[model samples]
Target: MKGNRHPKADIEAALKRAERAGLKVTRDQNGHRWGFVICCSCNREKLVWSTPASAGMEARRIDEFTRKHSNCA
Candidate 1:
């Protein structure tokens, strides 16, 4: 059997993609992970947060949202 696979790898990849898309991921003083995406053209910022278990999801969501709202490549 191949055993069970871990979603950590996929989550990490998503985080990396978010960074490449200009989303900054960070953990706040409250220990919550947050993704901040800022649009230079319109000066609009999108911030999303998630617990440790779903930080990756937040990153992916922020990236997608940022791309749509901002002119990020």
Candidate 2:
């Protein structure tokens, strides 16, 4: 959440990683532009987010799915 690029990508990258690891992504009843949840085998990693979370949160969320969980720091 500190670069010129959208930080939401970070979250999306995280989601992608989660999915690749056998996780699932789900949007709320509100039809996105809101937040999502990352579900693991055990439960959910719970990556709750909000738009303007750091600028372009939507795109950021998508990109975040590609990142590794450990890389989340």
Candidate 3:
């Protein structure tokens, strides 16, 4: 249960990556600086987080997530 302590730029970058991967992104409602990247065709999602220490990793995570779930209908 983390709060929105991460920078807004990081969150926006992650969301943009998710969008580029063809996933729908939505923010967490409980104050976490993270979002769920969902595959509409399969109705599946992956939780992507943004943190100062992991600023550069978000894109990689999104890439991996998209690849892993790419087979979805």
Best by lDDT: 3
Q: Residue 1's C-alpha lDDT in candidate 1?
A: 17
Residue pairs in collision within model 1: none
lDDT, candidate 1, 1-73, per-residue tens: 1222222554446555655766554433223434344555556665544345565675466657656754544
Q: CA lDDT, every prediction?
A: 0.51, 0.47, 0.66
lDDT string for model 3 (1-73, tens) is: 3443335565566566667767777767544446678899889887766443565677567667777766677
User: How high is each candidate's TM-score?
Assistant: 0.43, 0.42, 0.61
Segments in model 3 whose C-alpha atoms lie over 4 Å from true places: 1-11
Q: After superposition, how far is residue 4 of candidate 2 from its true place, in Å?
A: 23
Clash pairs detected, candidate 3? none
Model 2 TM-score relative to the real fold = 0.42
lDDT score for residue 24 of model 1: 56
The true-versus-predicted C-alpha distance at residue 32 of model 2, in Å, is 9.9
Predicted candidate 1: what Cα RMSD to the true structure?
8.0
